[model samples]
Target chain A: MASRMRIRAKAADGVTEVKALMSHPMETGQRKDAEGNPIPAHYITEVTALHNDKVVLQAYWGAAVSQNPFLHFRFKGGAEGDTVTIKWVDNKGESQSDDTKI
Target chain B: MNHHRRTFLKLGGAAFGAVATAALWPLRAIAAAVRPNAAFEATALDGAYKQLGGTPAESADIDLSTPDIAENGAVVPVSVTSKLPGTEAIYILIEKNPNPLAAGFMIPEGTEPFVSVRVKVAQTCNVIAVVKAGGKLYSAAKETKVTLGGCGG
Candidate 1:
């Protein structure tokens, strides 16, 4: 699947701030369609970030997470021009990964 | 029995895969040690807390930011920052949702003890931020009034 994350990473004072917006429906199983059929649960189950090939952050999500989730975090040890990779996997096994330079 | 062994092997393989994908990060250990699927499905705060394996101690060091009133329950911005040292993990929970545990984050060393994300609110309820630091659980909560419900709620 195509990467659906919009990521931005910036470095300052030996720290890197990473922000990302992920596009997803995040449908809860209880939600019904216009015809009133229940929608199956479909939401990002996990999200991870790697900085310079080292794991930095990981998040576990549930159906309660909002659609098109936004995430922001910061870490030390990344320098200018370093690479930060973000990846996510949904309950349906769909996945997306993308990288940005700090 | 053959069936038991097969199930164990499948679980072992899944645990290995989760670790390898993260390069054996510390967070992998925490995630592997605890399987919170039941917690996520729990309908009550106490039930979710029980599934998490520990009771959180309310603290003032956690900075939980949420709006006083959410115009739409479909999307509510939630952020948490822990002033406590040795912070390792953060969790967002909504008191009234069918599944109270919205998300969990593992914070590695040298990473700021801060996380921000959006959550779906089914109704007016208390939003809680639980932080695990130094092997102890601490939490802060704030009430958010939802003017309009969302998530088919």
Candidate 2:
């Protein structure tokens, strides 16, 4: 399946910075539709960032995270041409991953 | 012969149970580690804190940045940086949200204790960032006024 994430990784001075934007509804289950029925909760539950297969950061998120979530972080020991990957799993068990070069 | 057959059947059942448990162990562990459901379901700040099992002290070493006024409550930009040594994790909480806990991040070795993300603000409230370092919890907070609520119809 095509990934719903856009990732960018850059290396400088022995450090690598990663920024990712993911597409998700992030419904809080508190809102009602036009018909007045409650919307079911749908949100990303977990996010993992890996540098060359090594897990560097992991995020656990709730419904309060904004729609189309944006995340930014940095880690050491990444060089140019190294691979960085971002993977996310939502509450419904749907998962996607995307990788980019630093 | 009948007694020996019964014993063999019992052993087979026990072995099957053991295999089933072993197969499910990793999935259970991964689910628990991936999502702290109790923390996220907590509706109050204290409940969220209790779920996290931390008594955090107010700290100056943690920097929490948010706009003084959020024009749109639907998407408020927030960032946190921990200057504490050996920082292992960071958590974000919105004090007035229906569920106070918003997000938590695990910082592995060689990773910087900094993160930026957008969150939904239910109302004007304090946004707190908690950092776990060296087995201690430290926190910093900032208030942001919201013109409209985010979590309602």
Candidate 3:
């Protein structure tokens, strides 16, 4: 579905820092269009991060989160060439996964 | 000009009333449930802690990183890192939001206990980070000054 996610991973001082930027509307269902029509709630509900196929971080989010959410974290046991994967699922059952090399 | 001032005052009064009522609304029906729904709906921090399975939280092992002054409330960078071993989960809470449970993260084994993200802040309020590790809860809080209002304000 052409999910737009920018991911970066870097290794330093025995810690691998992973940062990701996911693109989504993140509508809270409380906003109204210019014509005053209510926008339905559409937001990323779950986000999971993996380090070389092992789960590192799993997050549950709500609509109160800001648009185009940014996620960052650090984990041990990753080298400069290791791979980190990030996946997100929205409230509407849509999902996306992306990977980056440290 | 007097009529305009009176109209503005009336609107202002009505807005204040709405805010006061919304803040005081008791949504405790979910408290009896076994799930974590009440934690999100609870307006007060202590009440939310109770809803989330209260265990005395210590602040020594937790670190909450945030700018002292947030120029934009729509996206304020917040991060939580715990030095405690066997950390299982971390939760972010904003004290004054309509629904304060901003985000919760489950930290799996072999992973470091850390999480960072941008969250919306309704106003100048304390941002609390709760960590569950080794079957116990720990927390740390920091106040962020927001110059701009977010969260439907």
Best by DockQ: 2
Candidate 1 per-residue lDDT over residues B16-41, each given as its tens digit: 99878888576656563343688788
User: What TM-score number comes out for model 3?
Assistant: 0.78
Best lDDT among the predictions, by candidate number: 2
> Per-residue alpha-carbon lDDT of model 1 for A10-67, expressed as tens digits?
9999889999999898998998888999889899988999998888888889988899
lDDT of each: 0.89, 0.91, 0.82
Better of 1 and 3 by DockQ: 1
- Provide the clashing-pair count of each candidate structure: 0, 0, 0
**Deviation from native of the Cα of residue A67 in model 1, angstroms:** 0.5
The DockQ-based order of candidates, best leading, equals 2, 1, 3
As for candidate 3, its clashing pairs are: none
Task: Indicate whether candidate 2 or candidate 3 has the larger TM-score.
Answer: 2
Residue pairs with backbone atoms closer than 3 Å in model 1 (clashes)? none
Q: Per-residue lDDT tens digits of candidate 3, residues A28-80?
A: 77678878889898988888889888878878887767889999888887998
Please write out the lDDT profile of model 3 over residues B51-132, one tens digit for every residue. Answer: 6779446678898999899988888899898998988888898888767778888887766788889998889999989998
In candidate 1 the C-alpha lDDT for residue B110 amounts to 84
Candidate 1 chain B: 10-residue stretch with minimal lDDT: B27-36
DockQ of 1: 0.63
